[model samples]
Target: MTGHAPRTRWTLRRRIVAVLILLLAAFAGTMGVASTLALRGSLVGQLDTRLVSASERAAHAPTRADFPGAVGSDAQPTEPTPSASAARPFSLRGPGQDVGTLNLDVTDGVVNAGYLDDNGDFQRLTDAQATTLAATPADGVPRTVAIDGLGSYRVIGATSTAGTLVVTGLPTAAATATVAKYVAVEVGVAVVGLALAGLAGTVLVRRELRPLNRVAATATRVAELPLDRGEVLLAERVPDEDTDPGTEVGQVGAALNQMLGHIEQALAARHESETQVRQFVADASHELRTPLASIRGYAELVRRLPEPVPDTAVHAMARVESETKRMTGLVEDMLLLARLDAGRDLDRVEVDLSSLAIDAVADAHAAGPDHLWRLELDGQGSDGDESDQPDDDGPSSGAGSAPTLALGDEARLRQVLANLLTNARIHTPPGTTVVVSVRATDDVVTFRVQDDGPGIPEPLRSRLFQRFTRGDASRNRAAGSSTGLGLAIVHAVVTAHGGTIEVDGTPGQTSFTVSLPAA
Candidate 1:
């Protein structure tokens, strides 16, 4: 089997134009061929009619016997008397005989041929040309023959009253020239006509397809919108002019408009549903916090009562208190997420990222003393205050030496760092080394939390920051149970601050990076 390459697909405009041109060319070609053939046939027919007439005239013409002092010879008289000159045969230059008229008289196998020149003078034919003329059958029917130097002729043979085979012809040069000129003119006119037609067709086609182009532009704009989340305002629609259902393009435009309308309604319904759910979660979280606190307080009271109680009861109260606190934390996380989803405004101010990193790492160290903690401030290890550092606008060793400051809600930003550090501490095994780094550039501030431990499971990486997404037992080695909302909160807070966060988890290393616009 042989393979063939795929042909390139042509656009609608190109295809339409090409088809139009091809059809025009075919039509023009057909007309040209028919016209040229008709013209050539008519010219040949007229020339043959004249040839027959000339042959008849030459047959009846006066011969040498009719002239005095000229007898039994095919030569003209060199010094003929006035009477003999007057009796000479006049058919070659006679009335209605055009230039280049050929005449031949054959008597008893002797042939004599001559033709009229352009100036009406008689010129004898060469031997070959005369022989060719003599071969014309004396059937009184005209036929075409090519003479050596005289070109082509339409010749006919007829016997005269005096028993001479007379052949007469007219050169076909004028007819051939006429037909050639007609063909040239026809071709030129056809070329110009096709060119004009092609131009007009292209303009008309483009004008007719304007509605389709506009519809495509509308679709493109709609596709560029961010419709994945939030309240999407699907306002893009094909224009009214383009949406008519009368024609093919109009029908397509109308259908697309209808589809867009349906999508808009569906999106509005979805957004409404999501809004209701968020409101419910927020209300429930807010309403449950006080009761949870009350329950924890009662549990504590039961444990510290100055009365004899069963150890099992005390242990049960402790467990109840722990569970209540955990529940309270979960409620708080949900409420915060709801607020963020609602696009609640937050306090924005310049906060030192370096200081935040130092505090977060120190806190992590306190919470998980079993793990090794490290901090890098602009590639220089530091666990100290950055408040006393020189202003970034002033000269410094490098840009990284400047305090990394970002404009955002201080509390939310701090929480972002806390969740990241807590995630690292809880997921990795004991004795794992965790690093916190902060760096500054003219445009942005960036921080990273990296740990050398069992990396996140591959299956959990895609939705690692999604709410309620928990790592499996292999990645979670801390004492506390996983609530799975820590990274989710981190992601939400960072996004709310107009920042971005990403995680890279390999076999033995995990790193989280956050970038924020500089203050």
Candidate 2:
């Protein structure tokens, strides 16, 4: 499996869930805490009321017999006093003291104390804990004590009989337990509530965004379409249900659908216009062929006749013949372009490029012998590991090596070469040197035509391969005549053969580079 990046920040669903949970938790926590605190305070207040009642009862209502060493109401004494004879085991005694409570009685500052246990037996308080209780004053207000071996106490002290003080205390275990239990329940409920809310938020957010997803999918399909050339048919659109303009998502969907409609209409109109132009070119080229042939034949016949025609008339007839042929060539070029535009397929075959260059260069030299011509080849990395093969058309015949080959129509490829050479020959000066280089790599072959002549003017250089573009001045000014379709035809043919061409130049040097896929 491939590694994927994890989202560091929240998504839309997560953001919604987080915000809603935050608000919910804040509100529920405030209420739960307020109620818990209120319950605690109310329970503790009741406990304090009971402690006050015990303190008051001990102050004025205890019988005189309720003193240390007094016997129980229904029986004789069961336990002896701690101050009794040494022979008896030490025991603590009190007068009618009750279990289930704590009792502290002080006479002449001498203390007697014990705490009631679960079995109703009195357990004596440790001396250190007893001393701590004694230091408290006989005030009605409650106090808390951390007694040894006894968890916590809420205590209050008050005066009893003559110079005697009484202390009453209660454990706070029940009240503490009640508050803790309530808090636990509240936290559990809040956690469950937040989880459910987060789940519901994610579901709702996904459902609501479905329409937008559909819109994006449509746009993505359109983006993947090939729209650069040929007829374009854009038919994808936002669905009807999503196109209602009332809601925000609906508004977006409606707008996108409308834009797609307009684009389809525009493309349809453009395709129609291009079709009409192609048909017109095909028809015009067809109509002109017969008349042009007749004009040429009549001019040639007039020249051959020995009727002693005037020299001026013969010269005029020759010009007419030449112009007619030029016009016929232009028409044929237009017809070929129209057919290509109409998607006519060319013949596909294997052609050796190095040999083709030699032939084209020879023809160019014959046509314009004043210009110096040369051929360049790729022998840069031939370490003898790559065996040489013989090629009938390869320029490297004398060098005992094969040449670069490409998959294309032989006739069209030759036409491309002829156009490029003719373009260079007619445009560059007589003494300018032209070089044709054929280079082969693993998957492509490049044919570069370089020249040392007055370069293309800067104003026309950018559109040098566009149809009808003419140079400000031709290098061979004495033979300056052009239809301006040579480079354009070169571009169209190269492109149809799955190739690319680029031109670059400065004063005295210019290069036209063409790249074709190797067979």
Each model's lDDT? 0.82, 0.76
What's the TM-score of every candidate structure?
Answer: 0.80, 0.62
In model 2, pairs of residues that clash are: none
User: Could you tell me the C-alpha RMSD of candidate 1 in Å?
Assistant: 7.0
- Writing each residue's lDDT as its tens digit, candidate 2 over 1-519 gives 998999698776678778988999999899999999999889889888987876666666444434546323331122212221111001123444334467666543345666777776776666676666766678778888778788778888887755466778777878889999999999999999988987887788778878888988998999999876679989899998888887778899999999998988888888889899899999999999999999999999998898898899899999889888888989988887888888889888888988788789878877877777766666533424322322233322234335789999888889899988888888898877787778888899998998989988899988888887777445442323778888888988998899999898899899999999999
Q: lDDT at 499 for candidate 2?
A: 97
| Residue runs of model 2 more than 4 Å from their true location after superposition | 1-11, 17-35, 38-46, 49-169, 177-204, 241-251, 276-339, 349-354, 361-407, 418-491, 498-519
TM-score of predicted model 1? 0.80
lDDT of 1 by residue, 346-370 (tens): 8999999887887787777778877
